[model samples]
Target: MSLQVQIMDEIKTAMRAKDTVALEALRAIKSEMLLAATASGSKEELTADDEVKLLQRLVKTRKESARIFTEQNRPDLAEPELAQVAVIEKFLPAQLSEEEVEAVVAKIIAETGASGIASMGKVMGLASAQLGGTAEGKTISAIVKKLLV
Candidate 1:
């Protein structure tokens, strides 16, 4: 099944299981996916890649909210955001470890014959396309910078 469909199933399961935290998170994901589909002029269906990107965006947002809440000494609020982050992460591809990301970065650098910071853009474009849902953008960028510099 597609990610959105899986999410919908899980949402139903969560509701039946009385998992408020999971239910809330799944509902928010459904809402975001619907919004993305509508925004893209697609007929209410999110493509796989689009679903991954949307889930990643939601996770990123929740992480930031959790960080801010923690910084403000509000663990009560932060916990829910962290829970949502976990839920959203279930839809993302298995994340690449730092070593794996570095290896991919190295391959891209060699493949593109990219040298120094000047070629950073070219390397980033290639690596991001290759890594896509498997890796976080900031992590990929940092690895690319470390390799290129």
Candidate 2:
């Protein structure tokens, strides 16, 4: 099933199961999808890649919020945000492990003939495209930097 359709179905299930965290997370996904579809100059429908990017953005936002809440010693607030992260993560592709990411970055560095930190941008551009939804950009960049140096 398409991500949007699958999300809608899950929303129904969450509602029936009275899963507040899942329900809230699913609703947020639905809302983001709607906004993307209707945004000025955007296509009426989102591609699968677009959906993955959207989900990643949502997860990243939640993670950052959770981090901030934790820093402030607000476990009560952070808990739901982290719960939402877990729920949203179900839709994302299985993330690459750090080792796996490092391997991929190493390969990209070789492919691009990247010499050192000066070629960081070149390596990053290629690595980001190659890894895409499989790994986070920050992780990929860190690996690239380590490999380059």
Candidate 3:
């Protein structure tokens, strides 16, 4: 099933189970997906990759917000963002461990014969496509930078 349909089903399940956190998160995701689809010129439905990218963006936003809230000593504000992150995480593919990501990045560098920082773009282009939905972009970028250096 499509990611959107899976999310809708989970929203219903959450409601039936009285899981408010999950229900709210799913609603927010659905809202974002609809907004993205409508905003595009073609007005086409979002592909699975699009949905994954949307979810990742949402989680990243929430994490950054939570960090900012925490730094200001406002756990009250930070808690909800963290809660939403947890719910949004459920829909994402299992994230790659640091070791796993590093391993993959190393192999990509080797396969592409990337010897220096100048080849960073080429390595990142392949990694982004291969690692999308399985790793955070920032994490992958960091790994790629470290390896390419």
- Once fitted onto the true fold, the runs of candidate 2 whose alpha carbons sit more than 4 angstroms away are none
Clashing pairs in 3: none
Whole-model alpha-carbon lDDT for candidate 3: 0.91
Cα lDDT tens digits for candidate 3, 109-147: 989899888998899899999988999988999999998
lDDT of each: 0.90, 0.93, 0.91
Where does candidate 1 stray beyond 4 Å? none
The list of candidate 3 runs beyond 4 A from truth reads none
Best by TM-score: 2
Positional deviation of residue 134's Cα in model 1 after best superposition, in angstroms = 0.3
Write model 2 residue lDDT over 52-108, tens digit each, in one string.
Answer: 999999999999999999999999999999999999999999999999999888887
Q: What lDDT score is found at residue 95 in candidate 2?
A: 98
**Tens-place lDDT digits, model 1, residues 1-149:** 77767988999999999999999999999998878878855766667788888889889999999999999999999999999888778878899999999999999888888999999988989998999899999999999999998
RMSD of each: 1.2, 0.7, 1.4
Q: Which wins on lDDT, candidate 1 or candidate 2?
A: 2
Per-candidate TM-score against the hidden true structure = 0.95, 0.97, 0.92
Clashes within 3 Å, all models in order: 0, 0, 0
